[model samples]
Target: MNKAINAELLDLSNCAKEPIRTPGSIQPHGFLLALSDELTVLQASANLGDWAGCSAAAVVGGPLAGVIGEDGVQRIVAQLGPELGSHPFYAGTVGIRSKRHFDVLAHRWDRVTYLEFEPVDRAEAADFRHLYPLIGDFLLKVNEAGSIQMLAQQACEHVRAVTGYGRVVAYQFDPDGHGHVMAESLEAGYHAYMGQHFPATDIPAQARELYLLQHIRLIQNADYHPAALVPALNPLTQQPNDLSFAALRSVSPVHLQYMRNMETLASMSVSLIVKGKLWGLISCHNRDPKPVGFEKRTACEQLGQILALCIESREDARELQFRLEVRRIMVAMLAGLTQGSNFIDNLSSVFPDLLRFARAAGAAIVVDDRILLHGDTPGKEEIAALVDWLARSEHGDLYHTDNLSRAWPPAAAMVRNASGLLALPISRIHKHYLLWFRPEYVHTIEWAGNPREKEAADKALHGAPLQLSPRTSFASWRETIHGSSVRWHAGELELALEFRTALLGIVLERAEQMAELAGELGRANKELEAFSYSVSHDLRAPLRHIVGFSDLLLESAGSEDAVQRQRFLKNIKESARLAGKLVDDLLSFSQMGRAALRPTEVDMNDLVNSCIHKLAPETRGRDIEWDVAPLPVVWADPTFLHLALSNLLANAVKFTGQREMARIRISADDHAQETVFHVDDNGAGFNMDYVHKLFGVFQRLHRMEDFQGTGIGLANVRRIVERHGGRVWADSVLGESASFSFALPKHEDEDEADDGAQADNPTKQ
Candidate 1:
């Protein structure tokens, strides 16, 4: 706490900006020397006297060759070339003095060179030959590891064995950049630190950058005092030397204090790189001052590399398998959609399989202003509101969020059932989408320490940001999480993307089919119009000619052959009337095709009663017994349904005129998709073989003399019912009861109808 330190701390943001590369001191485990291109020594570590048998005062401003001798300097210089690039160049063993061997590392920055010397133990050197076979076997284990988690666990175990550390942990990074100890191996009597989460700020961005550049870092002892460099500033630039690649370069004072607070005496870290990026770290800690030589550290680095490779391989295989599953599901969905008449109608066939695409608690589909929900979900109105919000938000074709409430605050109350939402927008123009939901998950998260408490303590102690202080307590911290859910993994997102692509293709194909249907319908309509005009004109002309000629002949003959003249006149009148009947039926058939549907709840009982009343005059003389059963209400256009029912009832009345005691019955059969209404008539039924021709235009089974009809009533019935999304069919046998039935959608429960509306309709049902 001096003013300069206080100002730097006050800036809080500049914590990562600290000049760690120019720490002005080196770790006591090694000595550092700064030299110019002319072989002049600009600075040397204060501890150089311990290794060079000289004082810092004498080494300062001295020739580099005179201190370490010309031969050692020459060997380091020979290895320093353009090929070394920006990274540190390892020159293996540089020299041996006073029964000690030293490993040299050289790096250049800003035209100034810095060389670091680490003392190597002879015993560790001798152990290298014996350690190779063990290292090879460990590598084999690393490559053979089954999963990312197992590989990381094995890496920590191997590092602990080779470095003889008390504890080793493998840490992994989440998408949010937070680090968590995934696997660990520790000595007895030590507290377990596995499965503890650390905040992202624990390692600053600058430190992460250094980890990427320098693959391995080690500290012999945190309590060992650092040694200063003589002639501290570079002679050429008058600046501190950048020791980024210095093997014994002093770590940040903040980190040193953190380690001391953690009671860690010595520590080493090797970057676990996957796909050339810093995936995590293999960290080793000891309870005592334990020094690891270069050979053992090298083996740990190699082991880390192998573990990284294993992770990449396993993850690649996992991703491939996930993609295959998505592809398979997509193929199935595509087939279901393309082979059906309507995409919306076919979705049900594959709706359950869609849930298997991801591990979701519930799912929903929205298209053409219609919604289909499965499993747990919010109310229909709430979901509609959510969809509206999604349409207006900056949502891409694929949108996902673990916390739905955070994105749309209204969804906060619905977190109980739908805390997470994964949406694939199938139609941008219409805002149609398929959504997968995840229910709220109350998770108990443990931390290395109370992050909030540590942060407060750091702020009060240093009057700065709290992230610099590493948490010292390793304990369980439990809290009830709310308004959130299990995160959607990267694999799920990729799968969603695949689904969107496939769904888009299906939608486009459906559009093409619809266009073709429209064209075909247009052409058919034009043909029907032409046929109607032609039939009306051509058939009426001949009938008019016969009537005119018969009238003229009757007038000319006066009283001659009165019976024959009457017969001729009767024939002409019959022909004219038949032609007029044909024209009326053709017009009604044409009208049914052109009419629009206005759907409403229609009580079948009232509709049937109305049709019968209208035909009372024709059934006055007949002893007809009406056997009418209770009929359900349906959702359809009332006008179209009235016409369809009228045709069936009239046809029944006409065909059953011959029966002495005519009987007609009306009833309904309810089903899941639609309700079938039957009109049975005890009449002159047709043969079963001619049943197929019953609903065809002008395809009457009975002769016109037997049944006085235009032969187009059933055809009109078919057209009208089909337009209302229903179907009409008939069943009859010769000399038996005949039944004509039509199916329609059950709109809603009869109880749901308003009492006032029911009274006005006055139907039995």
Candidate 2:
């Protein structure tokens, strides 16, 4: 018996010394590489040396799997083979070298009939993201033929770019193990295996079937030498055949021999299919004897899945092509007629193409109250009788037609002039008004066939043979068009539904944004209110104290009691000082909130050094133990940020004075969103329940005697934190120790860019 070897014969005019490049022409990833399954490199990428090392060019046509360092290549192949269990490549990191990593993925993705490649670096957080309605956009564009082929090409280019391999071909397969080249976006003048055919012996029936089921298969290398197969003892037959070769140590020789004949040492193919049939394949060919490992192989598999789903959705398939061509014109006609153009004109334009009338003149009635799509064919008397009958009937229908002249209404006799008539009731769920036309002629012309089939008036409206049988006539089949076709073309209702959802989203988003802006404006207004409160309270406090003292002195003037008056005057002076302090602190706190967040990379050690120097003069007078730890560099607003730290530090110094040797500790820590600084002191603290009250203006936790505070210091700290998109809080124990902490938002590294933000403005989010 002859082998079912499907192959392509070579045909060339002259030795095609790679063609010259046209500037701006689409370039291949590398030098052109083609090989038969024989495992000899036919061509290669221009810069294979980057991955294949210095001796790459010489390694062309060599056994690809044998050329790789055994450890990496062998393990990749093990994972490729069934013996390793179908563990996906993304399961974990397999630290393979760069070349093997790239090759392994390309090989496997194509092997299992999948497209494979590395990501376009998702690690970069600053990468640009598409601003349009991404989900909808992707869904629509992906189904276009040009779009799918472009996607395939992009996957190939990515592999070549990453692995430094040359050309990646978009290969497709037929059921008989024959590969047909579908699309190829190559790197250079180098012609690839595009349009070429590959034989079935290279990929067995079982393997091809597996490719359809799995959607991907990876072959890291072909020349993989496996461990010797272990002989098995059959439990029943006791023959070698009884043993399971499923876990065999080697790939079939027929498979290996096929690859050798093809001259392709290392290759991968991605199988694209739909409804259990082979559709297309994206095959990558590498010139040098290269080996791809497990991790890279996984990347390829993922890429293949992505490409396969894309191809399946593309309009390139025969059925899809037919559907797409028809869908556009019909949907447009529906839309233009139903929604955009004047409904009457659009309906009239659709009439000539869809239906015809030889001897008919009839009015279309839209029962203003009933809401129906009324046509004139059904006699006016018949329609009125039907309507009256419908009004009288409760089953949502009324159906008797032939002897309409005998019916109560004079218009009922008009039915005699009509050879055919139909009547259907439209309701809430089935919304369009009933259509009554000569079903024998109308159904054949407009209903049963595709609009694409329309040609002339004499023929069926769809150019198909007309059938006037009662079974296919209007009188009989009013249910079909009214019940199905007209209902399917329900453009207005569906559009209204989608519009409702999209409108809601837009409205909600706008409302949310407005609320945010309003809040910011409100905060600004509050700052002015706080300023007014401070001005009034501070001046009144001082004036009240002075007035009280003056009254006491005046009273003493008669009694000659100078000592009481003197004490009252001193109280007035102290109160005046406290009032002045309150006004100053209030202004400072308000300023913190109003300030803009100026982000920069701040060296914490240097910032702390400056803060310590400013506080050094005060520290010299007390026996305070100041412990400062090493600080990390952070990104933050400088002035307001420092104000927060200053307030926290001052609180520490003021509260930690009870002991003979006061201890104040300053330190910083890192977090996902911000850098937090803490000022810990052995001071009198407050109860846990009062923590919420601590950050509010004028909400003091302790009296001046226990722990001195204007009640605005912590509020100032909170204002500073929020300005930088961060928050601050504290924890403490009464009379034991207190730790005051504040956080400043960490600055992102300038080198990192947000890809999502196409416009550089941070305020846009």
For residues 406-490, write the lDDT of model 2, one tens digit per residue.
3435533353343333333322222223333332221221111222221122133223333110011111111122111111112
- TM-scores for all candidates: the values are 0.64, 0.29
Predictions: Cα RMSD each:
28.8, 30.7
Candidate 2 Cα errors over 4 Å, as ranges: 1-542, 557-566, 749-765
Instruction: Please give the lDDT score at residue 656 for candidate 2.
Output: 70
Which lDDT tens digits does candidate 1 get at residues 252-323? 866765676666789999998877788999988887888887768878887888777677666655554564
Error of 2 at 399 (Å): 99
What's model 2's lDDT at 478?
A: 16
| Top TM-score hit | 1
